[model samples]
Target: MVNFRKYISGITVLASGFFLAQSTVSTVLYTPAYENQKSTLNLPSPITSMVEKAILSPKELVDINVNTMMSDPVLKNATWGFVVYDPKTKKVISSYNENTPLVPASTTKLLTTETALSLLGENYRWMTQLEYSGSIDENGVLNGNLYIVGSGDPSLGTNKAGAWSYKEIVSDFVSGISREGIKKVNGDIIIQTALFKGNISRLPENVVWLENNNYYLPAGTTQEINPANEKLIVKKGNSFSAEKKYFYVSPYMNQMVYADKYDGDGILTTKLPDAPAYLANSFKTTLVKSGVSVTGKVTPRMTDGTPESRKMISAYKSPTLADIVYYTNQHSDNSLAEALLKTVGFQKLGDQTSESGRSVVTEHLKDISFDLNGLSYVDGSGLSRSNLVTPISQVKYLTSLMNEKYYKTYLTSLPIGGQSGTLKRMFLGTGNGQIFAKTGTLSRVKTLAGYMKTNSGKTLVFSLLVNNYSGSVDMVKKRMEKILEPALDL
Candidate 1:
């Protein structure tokens, strides 16, 4: 017989060692599995789905979200052109019908502004010079015509913020003339508008006119006058006054004409005729009021070329191009947008017609290697329904500017979602501050294009163009917000 106590001790030690090894294996495997199971059980379906989405790549997430948005029954009859791109990676994240051209509305301003920023630069300033072709005599008399030389400065006499008001501009001109000690002018006040050569009042072939009462007329209709019953009323100012008034007129009329009783209800919104002539008259009136006598009448000369012998008294510099661009994007100012287009044309192609501007912009797009296969660029402002553009092309154009020196200037000029500009009242949700974009709207079209900052600190360029959508535009906008809001957290 062996010693029973020694045998028991050896068995006990073996059992203890086996138990320890089992514990180590359980901690290494079973504990984590149990914890993971418990955590997964505690998460709801929505939370689990969110977690799954969080792990997906940006492209994957964008694709899923956009696919879902496009599949909605409400959008069954709508036409869409959308694209999201990553400039840093030079990759397209998601796209749906992006190559199809659609009416871009005010988003066309983006093209105009981008071209202006690229060619003219941010510091560019338009100059409106106060010049005289004749000499000033010792008797404080000017022997020549006082010319208001316009460089197609759109904001020349406007009262936009950061710009001189009409009153202030007139005052400055008067002061400039008084400083020269010219008490009397022997010649007429001539308005030189030869800077823009083509039809100054030209409209796109597909331009749509919207009356003040929200009536949409046929394309290419400049006015909505009842020719059989109403007569055109013409108003002429007799004296120089600091107050400037805007009058609506038909495209054919060069002078300010009122419709019927001039209740301010007419087609072709914000259409002001003979702006240069109006400015010239304003100068004449102000000069006379400031004790400078003019012997000749105010004349508007639309022909080209200024006299080489003309001397510049003072040049009124406009706010920087960046400032003008900021205002243009913020307000979606059609006049300002058109001015920028013509300006780029004048500076780049030496021609200020709308056609020349379109050419310059198209060439710029080509220089940047942007495919223009489906582009039908008609006007700088989206006032023309004929201005067609593909969403992909817009996104590509926007992405190309990311590496540019003026990128910051261009980006900041856009309206910030839920904060300022046209988007001030929109995107109050997750998109607030995350979106800096331009908003475009027309009868049946709604578009948005710009930069979006994702939750992961990535910047994306995107364009969403919708045409011929059924239902209210606000509903479409809400759907658009829903689609964009998800990308914010991606």
Candidate 2:
């Protein structure tokens, strides 16, 4: 999405009041070029009258700083776009190449998270129901299959030590089923996952690099893993295709890790090909320990054709949508963001694919009057390189959110500079929670977007996106800070 426009002859300023497609010709560093000169880097209109008036405003200072920083030699090859808008006045204070679409990276989560907040209310929760299709006899032995229908709750059993962990959820299920007076089950435990439609326990196609990734788990009796096994490598293979263990392990990572014991709780994950079967097995094992018996194996199905006589045994409810959004944006959780997108697609478009979800997002943006002319919303998590959005479009999107009822909730969920989430290490000792934003980074891209309160006590929505910069990340960051530090105090 980077606007790779390069000029070699004359300087021209676009309608956005900022320079773009400047000359790449070799010249002295920071040398100003005029329209009548040989290069395309246009010098701005001189402030002859302003100096004659002998008056200076913060906006003028910002303009000066932005122009100075952007004219550096290092940015000669960079494709950049930025916009600073006053939400209250609905006016652009300053902008440069704002309409140029660029890769947003994880900043795409803003669209996903915001769409989720607007579509799915704050109180919405994903529910997993437990039910049975068969009946129990007088000897406390049952002949029916136990069923678990998932709603694609991404946080299900994520925190191993939390109350809603896998072990805890399984314990709750076992106790509830045991209270039904059924001591044994003669049939297999059925896992119903029709709510979500896609590959389970595996990375999405766009994120194939995540394959064979190992997640560490704590060693404890409460946890399902053994103390000696500290790592769970998520891989894609079909060695146990006949059985339920369709997930493969990384032979290399397995051999490298030799844990004699573990000290903390493990990470609960569903990186298997069949997550329902994994859950069913974990549930079955815990149920047996809790004085219940199951003689059948665990299996997964995409249907819930139980007869009308089927009864609900118990259900687990997830945290509210607001809390989920908090974690999703704060941690930049790619999986949760994708899940939200799919959920949006499933609700609005009756499909769960990323394409469908992005369509839903586009529709929502249309409803808000966002200019989507050249923008592309491929995946919600922004892990894909296909996402493209202009800084002007992003600023407009942020400005429109002020009208939403959950605007405060959405703002609170973003990372506060130097304080929370991904921004904890950013804006240190400077912005220090004054900036609420989302960061996007890739090999040659760096972006920051959100709201920042200026020293004059006015809130401004801004987006700064730069791509193809030939410099170290820290160097670019320092340059970005040079521009932002003055703006933050504007």
Provide TM-scores for the models. 0.77, 0.75
Prediction 1 global C-alpha lDDT = 0.71
Could you tell me which 10 consecutive residues in candidate 1 have the lowest summed lDDT? 211-220
Q: Per-residue lDDT for 173-248 in model 1, tens only? A: 8888988898999998878767764645443334334311132222223434332222333233322122222223
Candidate 2: tens digits of C-alpha lDDT, residues 1-490: 2121321111222322222333433333333233235532332333322331234345554565466556665566798888889999888887778889898887899999999999989888888888887788998888888888888776776651121866777877887787888898888888877655552323333332111122222211222343223234333241211112112222322211212222223322223323345567789888888778788877877765654356888898888889888888887776678789889988888776666788999999899888997688888877666789999889989999988999999999899988998778778866787889988776677778999988779889999888888655655665666556657655
Question: What is the clash tally of candidate 2?
Answer: 2
Please identify model 1 stretches exceeding 4 Å from their true place: 1-61, 200-249, 252-272, 303-308
Which has the greatest TM-score?
A: 1
